[model samples]
Target: MSRFFQRLTFVLAATIFAALGLGFALGEFGMFGVHAGGEQDGAYRQMHVYAEVLKRIQSDYVTDPNINTVTTGALHGLLESLDADSSYLTPTEYKIYKNRPTTGVAQIGLIVSKRYGYATIVSVIPGSPADREHLADGDVIESIGDTSTRELSLAVIRLMLEGKTGSTLSLSVVRPRKPDPDKITLTRTVVSPPALSEQQYENSSILYLKPGELTAARVDELAAKIKAAGKTRKILLDLRDVSEGDADQGIRVANFFINQGTLAVLEGQKFPRQTFSADPSKFLTSAPVAVLVNRGTYGAAELAADAVEDAKRGDVVGERTFGEGSVQKTIEMPDGSALLLTVAKYEGPDGKKIQDEAVAPTVIVSQNTDDDIDADNPQPKQGDEILNKALALLKAKNS
Candidate 1:
């Protein structure tokens, strides 16, 4: 009788172990033998159920649905469930998004935002299409052709505003300064969005380098330009709107200014914190520098700013930066669809987290009401106020 009881107990234990193993396999690898419990398990179950539903519809539906469309929709729905920012990008959109910083395309040369249900221009590019149209800052973009910008997403508004070179967009604008607040139409033209546009201040030897995208080549080009100018007493590096880029490029760029110290550190789940530093010999360590940043400066841009500030290469000026210090790697699937997976979190040279908390400038300048404008002709009253402030700081440092 005792031997019989032992045999029964052994059988029960073996069954439980097999069930647990099966559950783990299904949960982790989606083998679909057994199921687990908890949120992750539920997510897996839902995915499995969705697959089954798709298979059923393909086999027994009244009419066959487009498989590609169904698959795309499913993926989109999955991403949307994760978060608003998480979305699938097609091959074309993915290429455009990834190469913007490197190739210098997709820049409309203006800072815009959605305000009070209207697409209002926050600031105009100094020499951009809107600036050339005499679009002063403080214009309210009422519509684009027949389409009202009311409640339009910033992405849609941007698509409306941007097009291939020579493509024109008609905008209805409401300018406060004009005698009559009427709709003004404007044409979109290809403006050279320079990686670095330099201007010498009238009275001081301060050189303002408004870097749109801080590439390694651009940084080198900027340094050469400043060197050729030969009289720049101070440098102002404008990093507003600059986002992520190649880490190798970022490292090379940082080497141009920093004289041998830790540039930034990247830490992830799989690997320990990797420290990147500048080579001592390659430092562009002469001039007193001031960095200009705003909420749009993120990722590689923020990393560069942090490196400069931490190494004492320059003082950071302007408004707080957009805290996006997480590092994402582009994972390409067998299909054209790709996933930008956030794999790691990084810190500036000063060991500060730039994820949720934006990097505060040494001199904090608030965005004034006069800084906003219309889309077609976004000429803010005090346009490029942040840039102007950076220039002022550079001049002061030189003086």
Candidate 2:
């Protein structure tokens, strides 16, 4: 009887030990129900499952599937499930995205956005394929080749639009003014957007500086030119349709006016709030300034507008800006893919949160007509209405 009890105890101990060993091995090798403990375990588990599913499909699927297509589809699904903003960028796509803000690539010279399930033409670059094709502002992109852009994500649409410099792609767009609401096809071409354009208004003291995608260095050069042009007392910094880029460059541009004070603040999770200040030495002009912003102004452009507004140095004009106040940090994956994660939120100098509610212009101006919508080919005489209004305010203040 004693021998039988001892045998039973030994067998039970062996069974318990074997189970523990199996659990550890499964957890370590990333198999079975056990999990390798960590904050990113969830993400890892998903990735592992994705890989296994891919393997299963490739090995035993009834029909032959293209690996590239399968991977892209899986990645797209994964990103879509995460959030609208989060996305998986392939190696080639990631490279292009990284260079988009810094480098001007082969583009059709058009500013576009997806609105109400359609790609809306916001601004047309003068002399570009879209402009040359007679594609006017407010045109809706219906389809790209056979693929409808209605259900496509913004990133995918942008990728499809961009290709090799000389390559061409068919774009089916809908013009509001056309008699029929049918799609109009256009070919793609290489186009560069102009940085700066200036003109003297008929009845205002304001010199309008329309800089589109102009680098901060280019803005500084233009500032010198503006100063050298004449003794202009007040200036209009038109940031309509301007997207965000290098914040440091924005700070430099803002420093030209702000003598001293905080420019903007960055608040991040697990990180301290960091304040960016303007140096007094970089003041370009002490003249009263007015900044013009529309719903299109965002990112670094919004930051610059906020800095100018916060310092009480300029009166913001036009409509409210597009509030994209989140900071994205790019993380590269092992396969050369990239993930752009929103790491922080930005605040204006006056402690205004700029995430959802954008900075509103003091003087509200609306773009109602086709002429008002066209930023490239403004009406020969009446394009600078917003600037003129701002200049009038400045003149009144001086008077």
Candidate 3:
């Protein structure tokens, strides 16, 4: 038993030391905040604890455990503990992630993130298969196919959810007020994001624009609409369920209305602070504006909404946004595995990390949670409550 323990300890120490040496050689230790002396000693102590736990699991288990599998699980849990965006991919998974097919890949249109160690639906794209199936936000996906999501990394879960068009993926989901997971099979399809929804409320005085996703094209559509609406119209930008897009697009979107002042800031331990200021050329209108957000609003949309709110360029209405705004750096390991580590995060004008502190609406309007609906009837029981509130605020400003 002593011999076995000594061998395990030696192997663990050797592996950790090699990793530390590689990181130092590559100057990556600074990104991970691993320094000399006290911090390094603490890290070694924690590693000893991990080894002890593994030793117990190997020796005193009901049956002989696979140490490799156990170690992989521990690595997964460790990265997830840091943040939802950070993940550890095995060698096989890293290959898949690196060579992931970009073109002709279809999806169920569910934007997912890890929450409580399970894959949680952040938003369902409008008119997509998931949307048509009534898969709403906050839905906990217990498993994908036969594999439990709890055992899968966020990257893996996302990869499993995509495939050829017309292909189907099975899911076990636990929704609000549901005790057990319901089995669901969603047909994957090439989800075409609906065009920027534009409407005129209160006799054309308020130009309401809902860009379902903050794609570059969608922002371009928004710019055109804002310019066409002219200075007389009050802008009502609804960023609900707008999770997909490049972070720069969000910055560009905020620059549309904000002629001056800071829009958002990006910084990290090693990443230099970059303050995104509104370009005078990009500023479109000085019209009264109110941005509407909900729990479904995430990533880039959160940045845009928070920037507007922080700068006081517009009133952010509705529920607090789904907190997510971080840039990840993919660090490849010597063993061919990889780590998707969040190196930097976006912050609003108020200097709050969007990932840590999501955008809070200046005027809070909660979504109706009591409404129960099935696949046949997907719409909520209540009307557009958030829309009504934003419209009221905009009209009051007009008055």
Candidate 4:
């Protein structure tokens, strides 16, 4: 009933409804892109239900319920109901977001996603705070800095991870096989993932290159490495646990292998469906290249994997990749914050949408344990299973 509460509720409701309306328009035009949709009548009915519920909580709920909490929850549900990536950004949270530097916002270095209302660690950047702590993938982040991550969106979670270097963020992580969640704190640091690295498989001509993170700089590094390894005839591009980059670099990596073909496609609401074609001139090598992938393989790495599989350029070995292929458009708001929206979804050359259909391996190499293995650091450290599998297949091809 208070004026502040009333205003907060109204803004939350209006912004969510407006976003839905915009999405609907985009969907109708094939530019409007979201995974969920409904008829106009249904939309109106839901609006009514939301309004009535909100009013009831305001007037009759016990303990003068926190209106901000209620509205925030509603907004999260509204966007999330459509898809995992959609979210509503509050003005305050947006301020903290916009203020951060574009390059190297301080971080603990863990790729994450929302699962069952909590942030689940998808992958950890090697040499990062999370990796140093042995924060295995699938570890559920219960809270960050005294706040539970259960209600936080991926965007907000990311924002929370970034801060001044040396500033520590507290985390309560529920790791697999652990009875109780463990308390962990990580100091923010400039997380610079490695560009491209190469090591020859013992006594084999096959070169294993791990392009750690597929950023623009890393792409150039990849080109140089490929040139250096000229005519090597056998390459195993390890893409497991690769991220911290954009889709463009993924295309560039694919371009190095594929010659003259549609590398991938993009579709969205608000943007015309577009195709990314690769020129024969852009092709780097046709040498028998095999890409190593696993569940840790995500984002741009998925693009690279898809291209290799689609173009028949190489064999994708190890486990299936984490299919994350969407381009986010961060729109700054009048109140000095932003709306981070998923404007488009990526598809492979064969037309399989990365968001839905993960890039499965050409040759499935299942590991004995399902312990969310880190692609950067394999267990047992000795006879590496996936790499050995790739080496055998590559050697067979040469034989």
Candidate 5:
């Protein structure tokens, strides 16, 4: 038993030293933008601090601690500190990620991201399990089944939520109105993307289009609708609850309205800056436009909202969008663990990184109009305030 303890201590020390060396090398390569020798020295000092902390933990802890578990958690924290999208996948987690099915995967229909060191719901697809359970944007998921989300990487949290059809996922959720966490069980199902909904308001003068997902096909449908509307009807794009879809498709949707100027820019330490300019040929709409957004709007939807707002092309109405726009590069470690690092981030036309600073609405309107919630009447009041506000703004605009 004493020999086992000594072996464990030696292993922990070696792991810590290895991590320190990797950190130093990354700093030397300007990964963290530390080019100065003074910064390098400071980094080395921090590494020693880490070593001291590990030594104290092994020597003074009341009970025998799992050194391997501690090391794994440290690596998870190291990657997560960079961004919500970047994650550290352990060997087992990486194996699952690599073997995850391309199609026929079941899910509860929640778009999730890490915020405040916990897994947060970005959006719940309409008619899906999560939406049916009344989960809303900004809701914090404290744990999944027996595991706390704080100890799990963002990649693992996402994987845990998906499984074979009919599989059950248990969750402890913290809602804004509820003080205590709610325990819920969800059965995973294949959630189909909501179809593009089009409606004409104000005697068909304002064309309202709501796309639940920003796929290439959806954007193509949007273009077809705009072209078919002719020169009479104005556009009111509803991007609320849009969290899924390809990022490039979202940029293409922006080009439908913006004929000129820089739409978005991608840049990183090693990645060359690439500017995405609007193509005049893709510009299908010259009519007055307004875009609706909410906390559920993320990734590609953020790109569209930011483009419109920055181009001064339309009024962006509703709450600030959920920020999420970055490209990740997967790096596999020698031990079979992997790192998903943010290689580049997308910036709005105004030079603001969408992932850092989410798109703010030009016209701010709360999704909930009710100032107080009645316990007896838990059901929300009828009518969408965000849509109404956007329509009002579009009604006042000239074609």
Candidate 6:
């Protein structure tokens, strides 16, 4: 963008932001006892600056500028400045985004992040093509479809992996052990994440329960697992890799353990204080439980961990969880563009926002990246560092 346009866009954004009505910001976050006139004075001063910039651009610019482009780009950048999750979709992107079906899309089912100048697979969804391909944690995906994943944003890399069902993606991945990257092709399909899995060490009272991505139905499945684990001396609830589930379902999962008290709290600028409390009738477990978390543990799973740790009902044993709980409001612009803005955030029992601060584990046992973690048949046994630590804690408490 030209300097003239850039200046115009910046001024335009400042004006639009003022016009958006920040009544709550002033009332909730600003200095108390400050008169409304004081706030108006500040806004007027900024508006005056905006006008000056616009006037200079209109009179002295070398070429005739497109007002529409300038305004749109300004608004786009303004939304983006709000947060990483906030995005401005262009009209073309909006069309595809809105038309996209909620039915599961074809995806490699990897939670990835930028690491070592490439998209690294943090975890793979069990039963998905990525899991079946034996993609392990800490595996850095060097390239996708001939383009280096390093050249793309994590979001773009994820989009490239997801499409209509039956689509295929070729990946060049470098496992921590491999000296050379391995070339692999995975065919995507609807991945219904396994809700819950249960296992007991042979001739041991230690029952391990792993709740996969906390989908709506998974809550019931988890309750059943807890019920069937009946009278187990020690319980290990593996929340590692369990993220991206419904907020309400997460509260439900917490409710299963917490008889009463705040399960989760939601607050925002426009949104009211909505506190979800536990339902005593839904309480499912009083047995000592241990929660295993990692950077991959997100969304609903994070909430579940928050409850378990806060209520003193269980010990969280693993690495810090990925803070992913938030309420996003997607506003469709008049031009068919949209802004996905975070309007509210999930708060833990102690009132810390989940999306801002990760839930720290009581016992921080981080996994060795190269350690073997069996995804297909997850039975946390000896040498499974995080789970073993969790088991030891639960057992010590049980005895």
Cα-based lDDT for every prediction: 0.59, 0.65, 0.82, 0.76, 0.82, 0.73
Per-residue lDDT tens digits of candidate 3, residues 1-399? 366665555444444444333323323232233455665666656756866788789879999998778778877887788899989899999999999998778999899998899999998877789987889989999999899999999999999999988899999999998888889998999987766677778888998787777788888888999999987799988787788898999999999989999999999887898999999999998888999888889999998998888888888988988899998888777678888888899988888999998888999988764442222332223466777778888898952
lDDT of 5 at 376: 28
TM-score of each: 0.59, 0.70, 0.90, 0.86, 0.89, 0.77
Query: On a 0 to 1 TM-score scale, where does candidate 6 land against the true structure?
Result: 0.77
For every model shown, the clashing-pair count is: 9, 1, 0, 7, 0, 0
User: Evaluated with lDDT, which candidate comes out highest?
Assistant: 5
Q: Could you arrange the candidates by TM-score from highest to lowest?
A: 3, 5, 4, 6, 2, 1
- Sequence-dependent TM-score of model 4: 0.86
Candidate 4, which segments miss by more than 4 Å at Cα?
1-13, 22-38, 202-204, 331-338, 367-383
lDDT of 6 at 317: 86
The C-alpha RMSD of each candidate to the native structure, in angstroms, is 10.9, 9.9, 4.4, 5.4, 5.3, 6.2
Per-residue alpha-carbon lDDT of candidate 5 for residues 294-389, written as tens digits (9 for 90 to 100): 998999999999999999999999999989999988877767877788889999988999999999999998887233112223222345677777
Candidate 6 residue-wise lDDT, 277-317, digit = tens: 88989987787888889888888889999988889888998
TM-score of 1: 0.59
Q: What C-alpha lDDT, on a 0 to 100 scale, does residue 1 get in candidate 6?
A: 35
Per-residue error (Å), model 3, residue 310 = 0.7
Relative to the true structure, candidate 2 reaches a TM of: 0.70
Write one digit per residue (lDDT tens) for candidate 4, span 251-363: 88999988888899999887689899997777877778889887778889999889989989888998888678887776654454455677889999888999778899998
Of candidate 5, the 10-residue stretch with the lowest lDDT total is 371-380
- Model 3 pairs whose backbones collide: none
| Most accurate candidate by TM-score | 3
User: What would the per-residue lDDT of candidate 2 be over residues 80-159, giving only the tens digit for each residue?
Assistant: 45333445577777877767643445666566655556666655666788777767556788888888765555566777
The CA-based lDDT of model 6 is what? 0.73
TM-score winner between candidates 1 and 4? 4
